[model samples]
Target chain A: MAKQIVKALDGAAAVAEAMRQIDPDVVAAYPITPQTAIVQTFSQFVADGLVGTEFIPVESEHAAMSACVGAAAAGGRVMTATAANGLALMWEVVYIAASMRLPIVMSVVNRALSAPLNIHCDHSDSMGARDSGWIQIFSENPQEAYDNTIQAIRIAEHPDVLLPVMSMQDGFITGHGVERVEVLEDQAVKDFIGEYTPKYSLLDIDNPKTFGAWAFYDYYFEFKRQQTEALSKVPKVVEEVGQEYGKLTGRYYGLFDPFEMDDAEIAIVVLSSAAGTARTVVRKLRKEGVKIGLLKPRLYRPFPGKEIVELLKDVKVVGVMDRSIAFGSIEGCGPLYLDICASFFTYGNGKAPKVVDYIFGLGGRDILPEQIEGMVRELIHIAETGEVKQVVGYLGLR
Target chain B: MGELIEIRWHGRGGQGVVTAGEILAEAAMEEGKYFQAFPDYGPERMGAPIRAYTRISDSPIEIHSQITSPDIVIVVDPTLIGLVNVAEGIKEGGVILLNTPASPQEMRQKLGLAGKGVKVFTIDASEIAMKHLGRNIPNTPMLGALIKATNLVSLESVIRLTEERLGAKLREEAVKANIAALKEAYEKVQEG
Candidate 1:
């Protein structure tokens, strides 16, 4: 509700600005391409006395995440950023951070895992960590990147959902692209994400709490069930935090962002930056008298299946676009498509849309508006004919 | 929903092509216009050909992809003209602004775009940079020629933005020289 400041910043810079406002107690980070700017910018803020947070330039992403887990377990608000191989290196600690219930926020600039090396945008990195017990949220542009980064803190630190959260933006596309972002006043952000009050801490010698302790069959299953219960509480907390943030910033968020879906007969579901491109095409198709819409998932983990089914129940044919392929799956479909299939199966009461999978934009390949338009036309044909073509197809593959 | 102008820049890794696009986007922002600017990112190796893109519009831009068909193309490194297809995917009636001492007609012939309904503009940006800034960084001067080719952003806003953004990094005289080169390129750019 305060006066906002407009600045031209890339997704990384916007996130760093949010971090500066959050001013966590500790930021243990290792530099990696695309994500490096976030660490670099935040480090400068630390050096310049703009923020009182302790900035640690760790040796590697693994060490960086380990340090975050340690700091967070010690009851200090913690944060970090990395991409691709860096995230892969932190694979072990990522799960530990979540299972240990340490709410450390991280910025994941989504990059393709390397074999034939690439330093470009893709969802493979984050999608690989979908079941890591950490809450995941994706951003479409710098504005969402900033907003989501700020909200990730609240979501992760909520008492009902004491879990780590990774906020994601597409590498090079959103991470490096410059656009206008209306940043909140520093005091407004500080007031919004108030002091981090931990009920128990490693530093609390009087009331000791054992963390990362080995749990055998006697208690392990119970701990896992507890984690599931905690995660089940996230959607409510996310809604409340998002609503409060909306009141402050006038940008309300939900489990997913649906565009023109109320009366649509054909639609597409996507995530992250590609959603922006799909939305553009959906607008064009709507102009041509086609009832098409798009659903962009802002939250990926604890997949909002029932809500998504409700949104797409009326649409005749729906296409699910995935930026990362789920290797060895049905037709080697992308991860998002598999999730959509599961959502429909579990939640659809015989009202499921004719869903198709589109694996696209892997390793930072561009998904143009025309390519999306072609998919929309295909969806129209499928709607009219009542015959599904291939369940999974690669979009714009050479 | 309103008109969107997309511009693509061709240059080497060390030519500040990305910064030039950012500067233009920032200038557009100053005019209360929405814009997106980014490089076709890759491993940054000096002298390796690279591209950057910028889009400006009256409304918000939701699409985040490479600019396939650019309305304006600025070749910051003249040597890249032969090594790269500088005019590929250019729209008809689009403008190609090259930083070369050669005439626009010569560039049109070299690019094989002669009589293709695409306008070509040329300026000795390197010469302008060397004359004023005592350096061969033609990015700023090419921006001036871009303004002459397409009045997407005001010349004054570009100069002011250049001064503000570059002033923090370079000496005051260097910033002034860069502005001078920009003005000269704006005055001397030739269209064919």
Candidate 2:
């Protein structure tokens, strides 16, 4: 490993640095609050001539993704950034980019979708796109955001999984929060990602291939099946890329990061920035002789259900915290909770832990350490008494 | 985990409170400490009240919530005293630094913090800035006063880091004036 440079940077700036090192052929992006800093920083890099990238300032997130799709189809590496309603705006093309098998990576600074018009951290934006066939990776801090951004490029471009990827960081909380981040040298990053050579290109007139072709009724289902098969290969690619990155940086990653799960009676499952807050409480509780652990999901899409179930099997009571609500779905629980429940149902075979859902931190509400500790205490009560007073709960809620 | 120092900054929208917190965090990192700096983001219009936070420790910081109980509170805009409660959740034996022309005792009386058991320090950072830089930017000078009053980080690192960060966008004379303002505030801060 080359000597790492330590710097104080926010998640947005860190991801921008990663993008700079990758130096893709195209970066077509439209700015939105929280995520605007990312493209703004990258634009500076483009202006300073530090990167050899074609930076296109698009009109909207839809146009941005559309430009990315066009660029990638022409056999060029492309990337973009968006948040909240911007992701909602790109909803149509988001699926197109995935189904077309274009390996365009995006930095999703997660935010809450608006009727209230708030621009802050929440998972509702990405959760709404959970079925869009994009591989989603959640980051807990600026360091993880930097690492995951670099990893997403490899995961999306993998031959076995030519699917779009969304590397996420909580807006304002992680995106704007400045912290110490140790960055790999630019040359090392270049060496790690190497180069991207498309299998077939629209520009290859000699071997002319078609894309976005109409496949109705008979062929549409088969096309979706192929997409599903491609997604199934993501976990393996993610692991391999993570392992390679770890060898270079000494920070190994997996499907999920489990903290003190061994021989614990109770546990909390969460994602993104809140997981860091929950881990602090788990550590304090463990010191007080409370058998509690934390499982933070890193890869949200291609959801690692079987692996998550294996880790939570030994715990008696588990609380899954979600920052985005899946309205009217299974007692109106949050999306992450619903997925965790489905994972337990499909893989646990009647021996899964008693799973509960906690819908928390909606609309960028704060999730304090004390609030997390209270949730843990509730989990302890359920573990000791074997009675879940509440199946679905609200944390940090009025 | 070593002791963590949490600081809260209260200012208006354009007073550079957020940058002050960020610079302190960066300076702490230069001293081989871990730090986090962030602002309470909102629809920030000019002259609107805002707050920012900083946490520095020997180990990595995990908590992502706003600091409820800060060990130090720096008030960059004195007008915020009546508009906002500057000492809502300060810890016992904590310190409160203000950029004001009034002495610390007068500030304690005005804010009704006489018996709060917290240290109060005051520095006329605006005057220092105007004397040196011909402007009223108190954030940089207040940073120097914060270091002198708390010893959070070495003053040398703050100066070097500030010079390096500003040198990219500022002329040499402006950078030197900013440094002069910082040193003046460090020498002139008064404690109650």
Expressed as tens digits, the lDDT of each residue in A1-398 for candidate 1 is 76788899999999999999999999999999989999999999999999999998889999999999989989999999999999999999999999999999999999999987999989999999998999999999999999999999999999999999999999989899999999999999999999999867999999998989999999999888988999999999988999999999998988999999989998899999999988988898889898888899998998988898888888899899999888898888898888888988899986687989888998988999999888888888899998997998778899
Note the Cα lDDT for every prediction shown: 0.92, 0.92
For candidate 1, what is the recovered fraction of reference interface contacts? 0.82
Over A309-391, each residue of candidate 2 has an lDDT whose tens digit, in order, gives 99998889999998988988988889888888888889998887888989888888999999988888888888888898888
> Taking the tens digit of each residue's C-alpha lDDT, what string does model 2 give over B1-192?
139899999999987788889889999999999999999998989889999999999998998998998999999988888889998898888999999999999999987888888999999998898899887878889999999999999999999989987798889999899889889999999999
What ranges in model 1 sit over 4 Å off?
Answer: none
- Give the residue spans of candidate 2 off by over 4 A: none
Error of 2 at B53 (Å): 0.7
Clashing pairs in 1: none
Interface CA RMSD, all predictions: 0.6, 0.5
Interface RMSD of 1: 0.6
lDDT for B53 in candidate 2 is 96
